[model samples]
Target: MASIANKVYLFDRDKNLQWTSSIDNLEDVAISADGNKIIAVASNKVYSLLVDAPEEKFHFPVGYPDAEWYEHESPNGQGWMTYNPEPPCYGYHLGDDWNAKPPPDYDDYGDPVYAVASGMVVYAKTVPGDVWWGNVIMIRHDNINGTGVITSMYAHLRDINVSEGNVVGSGQVIGTIGKGYDDKLPSHLHFEIRYGDSETVGIGCIDSELVSGEQGPQGQIDPTWFINTY
Candidate 1:
């Protein structure tokens, strides 16, 4: 099957058009392993069609389901988004910078960072002398809503509570916020959601065309939007 513009086309082994479905704003399409279903991503939502239906699937990184948190523009207390993923001179940010809501400074230092969803911890360690990423943890989530594998990264952590191969549950405590190895930036958590490769610890930023608003280049997406959507 192939998706073009606002439609999805189904073809047989001879490459002849079998059928087509009109799905507005279609972005991607995939056939299930048994060829009994079709999964389509459109307008930031997942559609599961019965090869005949369609359907859909954030817990949050710092708090539980009922925890009150804000992003970049919080008017309430101790947490807000400090920086959004955007293309800067250094390259695309590739993640969101979340800090305590108020009193600023290092007040949020040592605060616990939770896993946004259940997944296997792929990387959990500090890169010696790397000031940008103090202690970091990466979790690989597989077959999410039939969207395939995606990796969540937490950086500038003060403490790492999980190992490289441990399977963590959603909202599990994994680390604490920190001020990077060099103590240059204030206390905050640099969170990222990477698509495709789950093992590589990317440079955190890259030079490429921006997509879907402030979303970084390929391999990275808007973390806040992703959490709110999925």
Candidate 2:
């Protein structure tokens, strides 16, 4: 049981004080339904800390601790940015097609794909040509500002380094870029984050836009806002 002024404390099932932190203007305590992370929402920002990890901290899946990539915009008419490089449009297509792409070598073959955070590999599959996202990997995060059972998914890979039920550390290389398609759709990583029992697989994934209120909570989060992409 450790805490400081304006701090939030987390307890384990055994009633042990697992983790705690001090925050300014600590607001309501939000617990993940899985009880893996505890979020402390302050006045201006949010704090996400892992519960089981005593010495390790959560990190961005890409571009941190010596990793970088050229962030691309959705040219296929997904103008609205999302964690997933490719946006699966929902309802009807309003603008142009959703299969947008960047210039050549934007995402080359064998481009390294990384695990967004340290978590257990709940789902992993490698089936090239079976679907647009030839290979898919879903990782359930330990905690993100107390967001419970949040998941990060990587798709359209040519190779998969990890398998199901494997425990991976943050920033660990799990796969590589596969054929992202022709010039219309370059080889890039299709990534996304989900909360709760949301659909990790990108099977016809057409999520609604920001604050559009058209889609459910399956994954309304913008990955760019959650991670340190810049």
Candidate 3:
């Protein structure tokens, strides 16, 4: 089976067109009885049809950073990450790390942090501890042409300009970079995207798995993947 232009087409293994269904906006689906019936998902509504096996929708074009920002602190090869635990904190780290540290430039403190895409601000607050993300912002994007729901988070912020339930536009300045109470750390933005509600630590949030060793938010997607480049 395949989908095109909001329609689902069923094909036999022999490449023959078995049937077709006119779907308005397919969000998800499930099938049963050895491809005899299918449950088509269209947001709040679900439909049941005969003759089909379950199929998952592909997320195409993915999502690029719709926000306007200065620059990436760490590039591809010159980055650090914890996603891969070989050495732990492997790669370049989850955040694109725009305007990052090492030089401790005080002027960088108020550097503006922009929303990578248009969405509702779901969270913003301060978390305790210099290790955990101190100041943070989380935004939940509504359905994008049935592309599935996702969330974006900005951490280690110094200032938050948006509140919960606030709809923010792509490239809008939601806050400034801050290091929270970590006096030893320079102000830099730690950002990431999650598959769902994910998780947050009231004052802010943290991926326990990334820190300790328990299962954490479904996982963290590299923020660089969403960044738009000219």
Best by TM-score: 1
| Runs in model 1 lying further than 4 Å from the true structure | 1-57, 73-89, 103-106, 213-218
Superposed model 3: Cα runs more than 4 Å off:
1-92, 100-106, 128-131, 199-216, 228-230
Instruction: Output the number of the lDDT-best candidate.
Output: 1
The RMSD of every model to the true structure, in order and in angstroms, is: 12.9, 11.3, 12.8
Write the residue-wise lDDT of candidate 3 on 1-230 in tens digits.
67677677777889899888887766544433234444455543445544343332212111123333334533344332323223223322444455533453434676777765555667877765546577788876544325356677777788889886565555567888776556334555666666566446432224332443222344455445433311
- Number of clashes in model 1? 10
How do all models score by TM-score?
Answer: 0.64, 0.56, 0.52
Compared with the true structure, all predictions reach lDDT values of 0.66, 0.53, 0.53
Worst 10 residues of 1 by lDDT: 74-83
Error of 1 at 2 (Å): 45
Give me the overall lDDT of model 2. 0.53
